[model samples]
Target: MSIATPQNPALAAALILAATTFIAATTLMAKALGTDVLGTPLHPMQISHGRFLFAFMGISTGVLILRPQFIRPHWGYHIGRTSFGWAGVTLMFASVAYIPLADATAITFLNPVFGMLLAIPLLGERVGPWRWGAALIAMIGAMILLRPTPASFQPAALLALTAAAVMGMELIFIKKLAGREAPLQVLWFNNLLGLAIATCAVLPVWQMPTPAQWGALAALGLLMACAQACFINGMARADASFVAPFSYATLVFAALYDFLGFGAVPDAISVLGAVIILAGAAILAWREGRQRPHDRAPAPAAK
Candidate 1:
């Protein structure tokens, strides 16, 4: 049986909000696991490994319970999506380990900007002047956030930016696969393939987690699974453009988690830059949402 797609707009909005909160919680968990902020610090790869491993466990269990026939889809697209997604996740975890959560999250918003550029060649999508202008504004926002100078440059920010770029490519693959595959199929393939690939790195530097650390890792995986489910359900229920803008709430949740958990506040420049980037993204989403009926294609899947 297919998963139920929510039809109520209010419920869909609530689900999106919940999904963003869960995503923000994952950043906090990842930071705690990968940094000395909480339990024993795990290597970024180990953290990535645990992320996918536990996510696979949780999602697979759900599939068994709700949709046993969901397995064994087209493997080629699955591999492509998982490969890009794993690389993106690894870099993003590394970025969070070194940089403030808010900063890293803000940099990742460039996925949409990069997506527009990739769409031209990959999907034969047209780019109009308005989107080009939005991309320019977003680029300026990235610069303002990075503040790349001899005295103020941060290499770590580049990691997040690179992750965003990889995720943009991943979105293109998702677009290709979405039409032929169910959302749960894509979700299962991501975690399952991610776990298999991440294991290679984990075996070399694995440290047995303490009970608390194990709990954290498990929670991280569960949150990710839940978040993805909510995200897909919301998108299925509402217009993709309507759902897309709420994703910026991840940054808000990140900033809040940073302040309350780590006491690391984003400086003025970072805040302003985040606002600008969000504005550009909103413009892009709004324009895409307004596309004529005949011009509509699948909107990029949310992370």
Candidate 2:
């Protein structure tokens, strides 16, 4: 039987909020896996592999139990989406190892802005002044996080920015898939393909995870799967714009997780940049909500 998901804006936002918690926790897990805190740092590719492999396993089990029916998929869209999603995830794992999780998470809020810009070429969508202005404001916010000055420049932060761009590209494919199939089916195909792609990419960097590392990887994968499921079901129930702002709660959870897990607090710049980015994103989401038809919404939250 398909899961019942009645449209409930309050429930959707709550689910997204739950997803943010899982997402933030996964980053903390990734940071542990990527650094010596858990053991010797794992390669980002290897870490990404763990995420896909274990997430696929968990989702495969669900497929067996739930037995959700699927439509004939758009193979090209799934491949494109999974490939870019895997790359973005790998880059995110790499960045968390080197910078504060709050900084990395804040920087990645650019994905939507990047998605808006990318739509011009990919979807033939026209950009109005509202979108352009929102994108500009968002870019300025990202620059603040980059702290391009010699004294504060952290090159590792660029990985987060690039991840945002790649995820934005993934968003284009996601838009193509939205409303085309059951959300569960889309998710299963995504992780299945993600596993295949990440497995190939990990060959050069693969290492046997330590016992504790293995556990962390397992936790990371499970958390991500849960996050994806909550996000998908949530989006299906509400306008994307209505719940999109709630997703920014990830930064707060990240900062709290980082501090509790590793005692790292968000410094001044992290808070300022994240706030500005939220402002820009809120503008874009508000505008998109007003202009787009009620049926059009983001497919799901891409972690």
Q: Candidate 1: where are CA atoms >4 Å away? A: 1-7, 293-302
Off by over 4 Å in 2: 1-5, 294-300
**Count of backbone collisions in candidate 1:** 0
> Model-by-model lDDT, in order?
0.81, 0.88
The residue pairs found clashing in candidate 1 are none
What range of 10 consecutive residues in model 1 has the weakest lDDT sum? Answer: 293-302
What TM-score would every model get versus the actual structure? 0.93, 0.96
Top-TM-score structure, candidate number: 2
lDDT of 1 by residue, 1-303 (tens): 234554677777888889989988888898888887666798878888888888889989988888745645778878888888888888888889888899888888888778778888877888888778877887788888787998988898899999989988887777666546567777888888899999986798899987888888898888988998888777768876788888889999999998898898899988998998888888877887887632333354445
How many collisions per candidate?
0, 0
Among all candidates shown, the one with the greatest lDDT: 2
